[model samples]
Target: MDLQQRINAFVQLGTFLREISSESISKTSSSKFHNQIPQILQAAQNNNRWFTETNIKFAFASWGHALTETTINSWLSSYSITQKIPNTIAIIMAGNIPLVGFHDFLSVLMSGNKVLAKLSSNDNILLPFLVSFLVEQHSDFKESIQLTEKKVTNFDAVIATGSDNTARYFEYYFGKYPHIIRKNRNSVAVLTGKETEEQLLSLSDDIFQYFGLGCRNVSKLFIPKEYDFHPFFEAMFNKKEYINNHKYINNYDYNKAVYLMSNIKLLDNEFLLLKQDSGYSSPISVVFYETYEDLSELQTKFSEDKDRIQAIVGNSGIAGEIPFGKAQQPTLWDYADGVDTMKFLVEL
Candidate 1:
């Protein structure tokens, strides 16, 4: 199949996904993806506690809007997608968030390479369902896709996503192949104390979406000295329902107890905890915050440690910074770790 054919197939898949999301939620699914939603959602939830029906549907909605013809065309515009000898591109997915490695899969197929996906045990359900839809739309996809439970081998290149420790393992094993091995990274938001309540409310999505599991979810905040957090706390109240989840509550309670016993000062709202920390990766239900005096100095510091950051969320207008609420809604070109997956695949 040509690039246009692949794009058309994905567009069809996107439409099906969006329609099914609405219909399934309303108990009125007539579309192809509708009948399968229940089985997939149930399987996902059973495999991982974090994969609630709500989060799964949110993922569906995001991809449904993302995999459109316009977005696909725009993303591919800069590259020549041709296939003379299609290489096998193996993907090792991370299950922290649903369908996390799908962009790599899409990149490989769009560039006319075959995909050998080793599904993370934590994220076993979502991608395969979408892959089934793709195969149904274009039977040729069956030849281009492989889902394996065994160790990955016989691949021309590898794209693996994992934490820092696992990243070292990936490097040791897959170093010989053309690879994009990712490490632990987190997003951050900066506040100037001038943001409107609406903006802060939107920023709450950056912090709480996917229960703050995704790398793109903001885990840290930078605020001006002596900043008033009253408005920020009020804005984040929208996500107070997050406390209802036992896993999240357990983390909050445990972390809060640790801080209390250690006599570490913290700001708590009976749900979320804000601690004065310079770290970017915060525990669930806790947001680490640091005080910044100079915007230029902070920008410079972030630039030096760019690899550790996934997205910079704020209205600060820092170069390539993600807008207040857009940390989780990255475009096709928002390559993780600032590495272009499509470019890597095309070069491979």
Candidate 2:
């Protein structure tokens, strides 16, 4: 498809997503397209423990706001896109969060690159359905997307997202091709003692969303020395229902028991567990924290380990940091792993 046709297809897809996102919270929509959402929700939950109804809806809501024509246009404005000979790009998706690798899929296609997707077993259904929807909107898309489960070959370049262990295999296997291979990374929040209750509540969104599975989810906190845990715990109390999810509660119980048996200190609020550690990647039910006497020193420490960090959430002017409550809502331009997929595709 041509550029406008490609843009229009995604715009229509976004409109369809929005109708299901905010208009009806109980899957009560009468639209033909909206009716399938419940089935998709069921399949997603059946396939992956982390893909709850609320989490899938939240993912769609973020994408719904992002896939607008205005936002797409603004994102593409910085690039000098031309009608180049398209090449196939293989995508190895990670199924940690709902529609986790959709951004890479969107980038490759919008940049005039064909896709050969090896869908993650945990998330194989939704994106293919979306591709079919795009095809229905523009038949030109029919030839552009090729979803498969076999090994990814017959592609000029690749973009793969996986854990730190899998990244080594990807590098060894796909290194010959131009590629962006991602590894384990986590997000952190920097807190000043003066944060308002509203800000702390928003910070809870960053920590609790997706059950803290996503790379953008705040898994660690950087606090000042002698910070009180009462206010922060109280603000995050609204998310107590998280324990209702059996999988999450299992992690909470298991991790909490381990901490107790090991004689480690932890601040607990029944649902979430807080331990003081220097690591960026925390467990599913635990968030690690550390004290920083100087904000500048902490900033410098994080800057040196940027490869291990996905995002930094704070109110301070800590270079390239994300504001509170915005970690999960990345723009099309906020490339994951700080690698510009658009630039990679256009250069291909």
Q: After superposition, how far is residue 266 of candidate 1 from its true place, in Å?
A: 0.8
- Residues 79-176, model 2: lDDT tens digits: 87789888999999998899999999999889988999999998987898788778888888878899987888789998999999999999999999
Q: Candidate 2, residue 81: CA error in Å? A: 1.5
Q: TM-scores of all models?
A: 0.97, 0.97
lDDT of 1: 0.90
> Candidate 1: where is the Cα deviation over 4 Å?
23-26
**Window of ten residues with lowest summed lDDT in model 1:** 23-32
lDDT of 1 by residue, 193-226 (tens): 9999999999999998899999999999999999
The lDDT of model 2 is 0.90
Off by over 4 Å in 2: 23-30
RMSD of each: 1.2, 1.3
